[model samples]
Target chain A: MKIHIYQIAITLISSLMIFKGFENYIKGKNGQTVLKLLVRIIVWGGMVLIALFPRFTNILASTIGMEGNINAIILTGFILVFLMIFKLLSAIERLEQSLSQVTRNETLKEIKKED
Target chain B: MTYFENSKIFIVIPAFNEETVIQGVIKEVQSAGYENIVVIDDGSSDNTQAKAAELIGKMAFRHKINRGKGGATKTGIEAAKLLGADIIVTIDGDGQHDPKDIAKIIAPILEKKCGVVLGTRLLNPKGMPLWKIFANHFGNFCTWFLFGLWVTDSQSGFRAYSKHAAELINTRADRYEYDSEVIREIHLHKLKFKEIPVAVRYTKYSMGKIHKQGFINGFKTLYKMIWGLIS
Candidate 1:
């Protein structure tokens, strides 16, 4: 029932992340789909809610058959790591495709010049 | 029964930032009596294209941007195919490769001894750097381990391929790894491969041009070979 400095800090950080994720979706910078955007917003929003209300995490932890209140934070941490790795892999795939395209285009240009 | 001298042979020199030495290499090849020459300038910022321009009859290709050595070599192969080449020989743009050695490497292909002729420098490693020799051995070992193909030098840039082999040994690697990829292709396609001892001139510039990741590149190439096979 006590709001601490760490809770306030976590809430602010998660809010910023949510705002940036939405901003990127709106600006079309990341080429995220509507579904993907909603998922990101919901995920970060859930983090913000959990940060603001620590007792809610205790309920989630117990429901998930986890022992301690800290287990919720551990679960969130694992989810964040998995999401980051997924994002990195997709980004690398995109980069590889673009690089191959660039190389093919350049090769075609040279061939055209020869003619 | 077709001799290389009578066939339509196309020499593809893949050059990247070799503006200083490309002209001399081309002239040397011309002097060796090889009429068909194509230079694929892999988007050099210098006057490599301009210097090659003086050769009126030969073709010079310039990539719009810097594609890697593999891309340039692929472009050169395409140009050769367009010219209806019977034999395609690829040589480095740097003067490290001897233009005269083209005949020696192509001789096997002409004699029907092999479809792919690799010009190896390890036999007479007189002027070759010690690091390069080690690198070549390491590359050969990786090629053996990955593809069960063994050669004296798997990383040699100077090679001759029959038109069929050249067309068949396609690769997607856009860097120095293409050298290793070619060996994998040769093996996968079940082409007859031969190795010939050839001399190489290792100038300070050419030596410096060797990818510093020669050792690491072997592993990368092996990974690519496996990925390519499965995917």
Candidate 2:
């Protein structure tokens, strides 16, 4: 089935948002503090509804672009994109830890002096 | 009452089944000379309530079971506010946080600089577990990128908040996410925040103690950051 650019984007973004939101909720993510777990659950539920309702997805697709096999493409993209983000986070964490050690040493020295 | 001779600072110690750890925490805070300390029980089944029973005039609130860390911390702040505390500082019941850092943590707020003080452990992620270092930096980067503000560490549980910031952050997430989610609101509200370099002992005892599905949950933290970015 051919799809529209808008539909493709809407479907992809919504799906990505839902997936990431659910992932955070399941993994005990932090932003859930504002609405509690309700917001994450609602986002996950919405994703399920979108996947089930082709018309809803098609409407979103219509806004994105004229397309074909957009859902499959989006699903693939979501997985790859998340993996890439994961890698990016890992690299950044490694670098930050390396930089903070000196400050941490000074912090310990100050704590001891206070004693 | 401006950090003068007779100033009062109430501490909110959130204890979750902390029979072993609560004692030292109370003693530690007392040693720091913070008089108006309050411990919120958060419905612990153990001797948590009993251990903290010695302090006179200290308000204690207990949840039936567990309302989560965020709920417990909120209860402490609200109770401290009611008790007329000039500043409220949060100390972890578990021995993971170094109590000596309290003064540094609260200095800015005591001086009326920043509304909130976050005890950041970002200065030395190298000596820690690889997984934790990875997780924390990713979360910190997302916070900095999205909010356009810099906080060296976002995941540390130890923190100090001015009475104003305490009240502002009283309504935090009901779980660990409360730590990150509060950062969002702090920015949204345009409240000033500072990250004080604090020491943390990351022993196996202090690990996140994830349940049966630990890996899956860590993945969810990553997903949460991505969702924050996309949204």
Native interface contacts kept by each candidate, as a fraction:
0.24, 0.00
Candidate with top DockQ is 1
List, for all models, the DockQ compared with the true complex.
Answer: 0.18, 0.03
Which consecutive 10 residues in model 1 chain B have the weakest lDDT in total? Answer: B222-231
| Candidate 2 local lDDT, A1-115, one digit each (tens) | 6665765666677767766766777787543554534554455455555555556656656666645547744863595577558647755644433333332233234223444
Please, what is the whole-model Cα lDDT of each candidate in the order they appear? 0.81, 0.66
For candidate 2, lDDT tens digit of each residue in B1-231? 347355467777877887777778788777876667778776787878778876533355565556567667766676666666777788777767777788888788878899888888778554567776777787778667755665777767777777677666633244455567678778877899888878777666557544211456646654654454543
For residues B1-231, write the lDDT of model 1, one tens digit per residue: 546557999999988888888889999999988989999888898888878877834488777777677878887888888778999999988888889999898988888888999899998788988987987898789778877789898888899999889879878767677888888889889999888898989888886765534667666766665655543
Distance from true location, Cα of B157 in model 2, Å: 1.8
lDDT of 2 at B34: 69
Query: Residue B61: error of model 2 in Å?
Result: 2.3
What TM-score do all the candidates reach, one by one?
Answer: 0.70, 0.61
